[model samples]
Target: MRFLETDEHDDPILSVVNLVDLFLVVIAVLMIVIVSNPLNPFSDKSVVVIENPGQADMRMLVKDGEELREYESSGEIGEGEGIKAGVAYRLADGRMVYVPEAPAGGASGGAASADGAAQ
Candidate 1:
């Protein structure tokens, strides 16, 4: 067991493990920086961005378009409001579905023959 740990104080394998650990930490920190940046592809200020990806700290950012609205970190359960556009159902063929938004009772009126067929 001791040999596996290190043959001496300056073991090359041990140094490699330490270097790998350092690199891992650096990668983790870089990931955090990228996610926190506003220009990041996955950065969403409106919705909650988990503080540490998985470790939620009850902190959130509310964005309105390009505007950076606010940050809430009360560390308490919160609720938000938004207009529900529509629903979606997925097929069994590994495809996605997205139902479009429409006004209430709009289906019949929208398809009632715009050319005035009844006339």
Candidate 2:
């Protein structure tokens, strides 16, 4: 039949089908990006994201459970209510080590060094 022999390129429905396929590919890619994002709302895992690290205009986004919180720095050294719980010192090789203070009454029995030796 002549219809069977006609050029498919002249058919408008073929173009629509191709357009739909292109849209489907675009939608799939967008979904993948959204799902892979650490801040996705549907995800249950807690996530912390820092922006502009070490810069004055730094910001932080913390996501816990279903809640999200944002913090912006004022570019000054942070001063807050917190107690000194540990000490850190740089070694000769430039590596830093931390030593936590023993709890009151020596609840931990003794302080352990980085090499697990009692101090």
Candidate 3:
């Protein structure tokens, strides 16, 4: 504690203090980079998802401005005018399934016609 000066300029402690300050600045910069990264877990873009992976089993048909029909898993997809109805699904065991043909008349009439046709 002598007054005003001894030659303390050669001390090793000053270099160590400078090294500690540099490390503090590097850690602060790294924290800012981590917070700003686009792929961070809290980012908004990570939330939305898509569920389906393959062709859909159902569809809707629209004609003019009208929704003309809805289709289902029964292989009954609607055919547009030039398009003929075709067999659609093959099961995993290799059997083909097709939409059933519409009855020529109502059910009772079709039954009677079938009996007549068989005779």
- Top-TM-score candidate index: 2
Residue-wise C-alpha lDDT for candidate 2, range 24-109, written one tens digit per residue: 99999999999999999999999999999999899999999799999999987867897888887776886556778777787644
TM-score of each: 0.32, 0.74, 0.31
Candidate 2 lands at a TM-score of 0.74
- State residue 23's C-alpha deviation in candidate 2, in Å: 0.1
lDDT of each: 0.59, 0.86, 0.50
Which residue pairs overlap in candidate 3's backbone?
none
Overlapping backbone residue pairs in candidate 1 total 0
RMSD, every candidate, angstroms: 12.4, 4.4, 17.0
lDDT of 3 by residue, 1-119 (tens): 65656566767898899899999999999888987754444444432222232346544332322223333444556666654433345557765545433445734222112123311
Q: lDDT (0-100) at residue 107 of candidate 2? A: 61
| Candidate 1 per-residue lDDT over residues 1-119, each given as its tens digit | 76567546786888999999999999999999998776465644444343443344444555545555445455557689978876555557754455556777776222212233321
User: Which residue ranges in model 2 land beyond 4 Å of their true spot?
Assistant: 1-5, 80-87, 93-111
